[model samples]
Target: MGLGTGQGLHYETAERLSAALASRTICSVELVESLLGRARTIDGKLRAFIALDGADALRQAVESDRRRERGAALGPLDGVAVSIKDNMSVRRWPMSCGSRMLDGYVSPYDCHVVERLRAAGAIIFGRTNMDEFAMGSSTENSAFFGTANPWDLGRVPGGSSGGSACAVAAGLAPLALGTDTGGSVRQPAAFCAAVGLKPTYGRVSRYGVTAFASSLDQVGPMGRSVWDVAALLGAIAGLDRRDSTSSPLAVPDYTVALGRERRWKIAVPREVFSDGLDGDVRDGLRRAVDFFAGAGCEILDVSMPAMDISIGAYYITATAEAFSNLSRFDGIRYGHRSKVAGTVGEVYAKSRGEGFGAEVKRRIMLGAFVLSGGYHEAYYGRAQRARVHISNGFGEIFRNCDFIATPTAPTVPFPVGAKTQDPLAMYLSDIYTVSVNLVGLPAISVCCGFSPQGLPMGLQLIAKPFHEEELLAAAAFFERNHDFCRRHPKIDQ
Candidate 1:
């Protein structure tokens, strides 16, 4: 564990060392060997980690140098060193839902945020790529790998947590752990500038993740700021009696909700910037609404006709709950089984047609032809009444603006095989964060500007159900009045 003095760790933000590591002066094997040496020197150019535990991250930085020579009590992400996105799950590794029929499937346990980041001594240090099973947007449908876009590798890092937004946009994991069902960790941390979060829907703890549309999945935190996505969402949020949709509440102190009371009101949504939009994502949401109306708050101007049927109501409730949660990868109990089957429906259709991948067999044959039976009431009961009319149009625009800001994505990272044979033009590139994951509220994206082809451009914020500390203090007040983390994308420096 002698990377012990990796010198003044750059970009690390857990409120500047969670009280300077209580007294460890930066020794968690020097921040997990300087983030496993920038995830092994730029993860072969951003194909963001799918496994590289570096001897279990130097044996958990040598058990936090033996609990700091036996003083013990740590936890506030103790040795903090996050990163986990291979559709989540961490225990004996390989929880591959990026499908090759769960290529080397291994999980047996751990994943209530990997047991709260290994009981807050945090260091999962590996597994990233996503899409298959997590179902695309762009981690380029991950049959196994292909993340890129660490600020323009040929564009597109936005994704099914595009390798956890190119591992915290190529700083290579100062933080990570994404999920978001539709916006897949805030559209790959806004096409990879970084600072995601989706929470709210049962506020973090989907037991062991890996289910795509479980009433629109969650599990937030991606970073580079916004107090390191609210200190990795206050160390993986709470209440998980092993997640019966967790959320029993009382998990505040999200970095004390970012210097509280910068005062807010927000809500812009005139049907999400009507028209094709792409003049730098509409001048970066009109310069984040004129820097939040020159910082005195109050922006109002709502309306929501279910935002014109939220991308055909989120592709008919996420392909009818991804054809019933990918029908538990039928190849016997765990995953990958067919070595020429003798017919148990020919080993569940030839081990998921030879372990899926053709945009995951065309979204599992269009979600088994739209939930079969003569098209289950013309597509999953009309996308569950357009998810209660877009959850009452975000409950009537959070009742006149307590949050709503928009533009998490309209266009900016597309170019890696751009819209690969147009899957409904990449499912209308998640039409502005898929109706806040079909009504389970809470969003967040951040960055807020960029794109003249230099990519990057975010700004989402949202709120409502369980609010994620008022959507991370309204995206940390436009990441502190429009400085926007000093403009990222110059090949993620």
Candidate 2:
């Protein structure tokens, strides 16, 4: 139960591990063993990973060590153990996306991000659990199992990247990759009190990530510190021929932005903060604003009226896309097929019904309704127009400000199953974050403060498209003044 051999390495940030590996002071094999050992002991109750290929991870570690000894190490991530969300494919690993549909399916190829990590010599540690097909806000929708918050085991880790956040927060790994489709990465990061960055849509390639709202889905990085997050982002971000949406712009050296000071024009979206925000989160936002103002940054009140329609617009658009993307899972191509079905039609219908969880089914039905012939223009078309208005509003605001600041979520980590029976309540958890995805802007969540009950709250900073450097720099400035990221949750005590 104790950290065992991996005690010293458990809380080390990805940046620290990379340095240790590069200097030969610590080998990748040792670090991988320590982490794998810890995961074996702690992950049982946390339910963070759906798959942990320790043997393969150690083999990768040994290879990294050998390369380091030969002075041929790939890069900064050479020896770091990186946890991957179950939705991102890692060759030969199970990529269930916490769904029964792809339950036993092994990926034949690595995702674009995974390919980058492998090339960087990172030890592809494990596949973390997620909401089924990334449909739910809380991990309770995971068809297999739910991941618990490390700070409070009885509470839910926000999702659909709950397991990825829990892995980093619980010290199973110092770095992780999560997909953000309407706050999946940032919300969980906020709940777990970690740093998470969702890059500008198309900034990072999304070739092999299992589709979920294709237009909004993006691979992101999560870590214990701003530097670690920036580093991970740098490693995996670049142009990929396979992903048509990937930007051709050069990937900046994100680490250079760390520890730098610059006077920033920060916009506070008044509409977002006016109501429905929890007192603790509001307090955290106030403190964050005060800190930035004290640091000589200018804070201006701004308006994004269309943002008021973000939640409704996002669900409509995302669900419609999900419905289209998920149709391929119907027994014919790959994934779970119902044996009870005697005919092709029955196979398609029964397999999907049996394979999908409640949340997934609900979204699919809603999506079908919205995309139906008569309602398509009324619902889907309206949502698309709303998305354009929201994007334009963000565009106008960003032209004046360096970044936009707001609370990451309306509330802190909630008790597991508390909102499971009520989907609307669960959806509201991402009220503040959905807009960024809808607009294709870059955003990050950093721990701003904690509630009286000790749950963490996050301050979100959003930047213009392809401006992750500016976003990460601003987050690092705040991280420099706070120790929230340095402190690990005292779970199992």
Candidate 3:
């Protein structure tokens, strides 16, 4: 159980692991082996990883260690094992996005984030599971298998980044990368007691990443602590010409913002605290508010009426984009093709029909309907207009407050089958998170407190676009005063 031991190395924060690697207290190979062994021992129950190439990972680790011995270390993240969500491409690795549609599809090149991680000397650990096409709020929609919450095995890990969140929470990886279009990173981090960051849209490039909702999707980082998330973010966030939507802003040293003292103005949206919120979650939010207040931070009540329609607007907009982006997967290219098909049209029809899971098909159909004649203006157009209004609302709020605070999710992690049959309830899981994505702002979820049922809850802090440094600082302040991140789930191996 000692910090110097191999068993303890797997659960250590990336920050500490980096230090260990730098000092040669332990080599990168030892760290990778420990994590691989841990995953081999417990991943059957959690189902966090879709695929793990231990040989490739070790090869990368050995290179990292050699770089350090030769005094050519890449950076602080060098030698760290970072898990990747299945949606992001890694050269020669399967990028299925937890869908049968992309079954056996391997990428020839690394995604933007993966490229950055390699430059920083981080090892690509494995591909974690997720909701098929990143369409579901819970990972139960994954075509392969559902990931379980590490806190309570019976409960579900929030998704479609559940596998990434579960891997970090269960001590399988020190840090992980996840794609958060609508709370994929934060909600699961909340449900699993970890830290997740959804950076400002365009802050990180989206090229080579499988698109779910093109306009909304952003590469995010998940880890056991705010510092860990900050370190990962520092590495992967920057301008990329490959993605037209990528911002040209310079990436800041995110770790520098941590541990800095600041009295920030935090806005609490009154609309987010509704009757739908679980009492335990509400209580946790209240405690978080009190903590900030006690820390001399100014807390104000703000109203965002657009939040009321964020879910609807998000679904319309995201689904429409998903439909357009997914059209390329018609089985003619490199994805899953139907073995039994007569005509080319039948190939397209049967391929999609057989390849896509229920949730993905539902979203695609919904997207098609909204984009269809006579309905585009009625649904998709209005959603676009609503998106503007929502962005304006956040702009107004930011005019007075530095950040917005809310519960990451209305409830703790639900049982695996609890809301699977009720899609509406499942969709509501991202209620507090979608608005940030809609506005293309930066937001983070840190473990605020635990529910009465012993489940973790998150306090989501959102900031203006490209203000990740400030947002991370505020979350780091809270994390420093709380012990939530230090606690780990006891998963029996």
Best-fitting candidate, measured by lDDT? Answer: 3
Sort order, lDDT high to low: 3, 2, 1
Question: Candidate 1 on 1-493: residue-level lDDT in tens?
Answer: 2222343453556656655666666667876777777666668777787777788888987896688668784666777778788777777887786778887678877788878778778778888888777778787888866788877787768788788778777766678887888898898888877889898888788888877678888888888888878878888888988678787888876877676665578878787777766778888888888788887888888777777788887877777677788878989997888899997999998998898888767776777888888888888888888789789878877876778887888887888887888889888878888888888888888888777656787888787888788678778867876665655444435
Clashing pairs in 2: none
Ten-residue segment with the worst summed lDDT in candidate 3?
1-10
lDDT of 1: 0.78
Worst 10 residues of 2 by lDDT: 1-10
> Which lDDT tens digits does candidate 2 get at residues 314-342?
99999999899989999887789998999
- Work out how many backbone clashes candidate 3 has: 0
Comparing 2 with 3 on lDDT, the higher-scoring candidate is 3
**Collision pairs in model 1:** none
- Give the TM-score comparing model 3 with the true structure, all chains together: 0.98
Residue-level lDDT of model 3, residues 338-413, one tens digit each, is 9999999999999999999888888999999999999999999999999999999998999998999999999989
RMSD of each predicted structure: 18.4, 2.0, 1.2
Q: After superposition, how far is residue 420 of candidate 3 from its true place, in Å?
A: 1.2
Identify the runs in model 3 with alpha carbons over 4 angstroms from their true place: 1-7
